[model samples]
Target: MNKQKIAVLGPGSWGTALSQVLNDNGHEVRIWGNVPEQIDEINQFHTNKRYFKDIVLDPAIKAYKELSEALDGVDAVLLVVPTKVMRLVAKQVAETLDHKVVVMHASKGLEPESHKRLSTVLEEEIPAALRSEVVVVSGPSHAEETIIRDLTLISAASKDMETAQYVQTLFSNHYFRLYTNNDVIGVETAGALKNIIAVGAGALHGLGYGDNAKAAIIARGLTEITRLGVEMGANPLTYSGLSGVGDLIVTGTSVHSRNWRAGDQLGRGEKLEDIERNMGMVIEGISTTKVAYELAQELGVYMPITQAIYSVIYQGASIEEAIKHIMSSEFRQENEWS
Candidate 1:
């Protein structure tokens, strides 16, 4: 593989892990973050203690406080920030771009206000002249596991196959493998919607429900995700691929999942504000649950799992009551269309 210079915008755990991957691939990586102290720690000590704890980052990975410096002359950019601030960061990157660069984002979650996918937000913020087709890199991988160089498989998707392939080539390595897909809508939708289900699964675990209950959540939650994704113009088959079922399985079952952790806290009777404060990082599913609930209603999609999670988070519904309602709801054929 030809060596490339890549700018990683966001020095969070995901961003740091991806930067290490790129560095290991013999690429030059520059990471940018808003926090000066984090940047300093990364540059001086090769560690981002706030995110990765005691893990040491590759010394070759550079951290930048200035967005322009990070973007200068880079071949591509990877966005790993929270979905909530994607637009703001994209606009900043757009202003500093001097040439067209392949732009890929690994953030998962829809814009709550506009219900827009992260790629759409990037397209609106970054002019087409300065950026290639937006690619979404998503799947079952978590930063904690990825940083440890654990085996991980993910997908890089775009409407343009060549764009996806380019990203696939850029990030793939012995430990980190990537597949290319042209289903941008499906990939983005699956990546965003799975977090909602993960929250439900975590809630199930917190409620002292056994593996059987968690399994049920995963199955029903996937149905709800597929219904909404299909309504949003995503290919139905995409939900079965790495971005869909694969992602849902990992996020729902792993303690590494921030959404699942938040949900678990909620199940234990913690308030949303307290959860967020303790998380220190963004709990994307909380906002995503609200968005998915609203979208399901607007699109006339039936999503009981999503609704239950939303009620728990927003309507102050008791966890036991929500699960009871789901269990008592009328049953339909397993393959019944929503």
Candidate 2:
């Protein structure tokens, strides 16, 4: 195992929160943010005012405006930027990165138009010649809860076990737990598709659907995610773990969730463009649902919940119509796929 200097590459809620955890763990940390004012606040006040105001940042943490400075001499890096900018940001880090330091990411969701999982994009974007050190940290981690030092658990996955363990230590705190897994594909795939389900579940909640429907959505949503993930060569059990089921439960129902907020608007008959533009946060569910809908088509999988979400958002299907469609569908034994 290597003692590594880590850089968290984004300064959004997730990025800032990850940096705070690492700083608390006594690792030398630096971060690069595109926003000049955000960087200034982090440096001078030792706090992230944009997303996390209640938690005080450790004074020892550092910030760099330049990509070179952020990636310089770091043994590992966490790519915490949005899914859309992942490739562009990864390329910048790959150019200056030292081979000894591994790369870990905390971002989730696939590129909708490209239909690529985040890890696939990372593999393609990062300089292939830099050597294999890519891993992902995901699960039921929310930036708001993490900033308050809540007990959060995440699954760290890699093709390499040592790298995964290294990541486990980088962000793990007394209040935060990290678990290791070698199923990188499983972890990333589940992480992406599960967001789509969360959005659907949120839509159900917003429509005043009862707990019966919520529980059904949660279970059936896992089934859809698992089916797709398994088709992509992921472990079936990964969906049952924290990064899969745990994430779905949190992002599905939490008021702090941007994805759920978007889903609620859709349930309330708000336009997708308006919801997206007005929310201002990265409502990953919007993008993830579209990608998952296409993926289900490509894979010939029956993902009814995902399809219903796609219908409501893109096909101009009404909330009541989607609900009726789901309820009116054909019936089957519960253990058919189990």
Residue pairs with colliding backbones in model 2 are 75-101
Please provide, for model 1 over 1-338, each residue's C-alpha lDDT reduced to its tens digit, 9 standing for 90 to 100: 69999999988888889999999999999999999998999999999888888799788999998888999899999999998999999999888899999999999999978999999999999999998999999998899999999999999999888888988998898999999988889999999999999999988888788999988999888998999999999999989999999999999999999989988888888888998999999888889999999999999999999999888888988999998998899978889878
lDDT per residue, candidate 2, 193-291, as tens digits? 877877777788778887898899889888888888888788989888998888888887788888877877777777789988898678887788888
All candidates' TM-scores? Answer: 0.98, 0.95
Model 1 clashing-pair count: 0
TM-score leader: 1
Compared with the true structure, the alpha-carbon lDDT of candidate 1 equals 0.92
> Model 2, clash count?
1
Model 2 quality (TM-score): 0.95
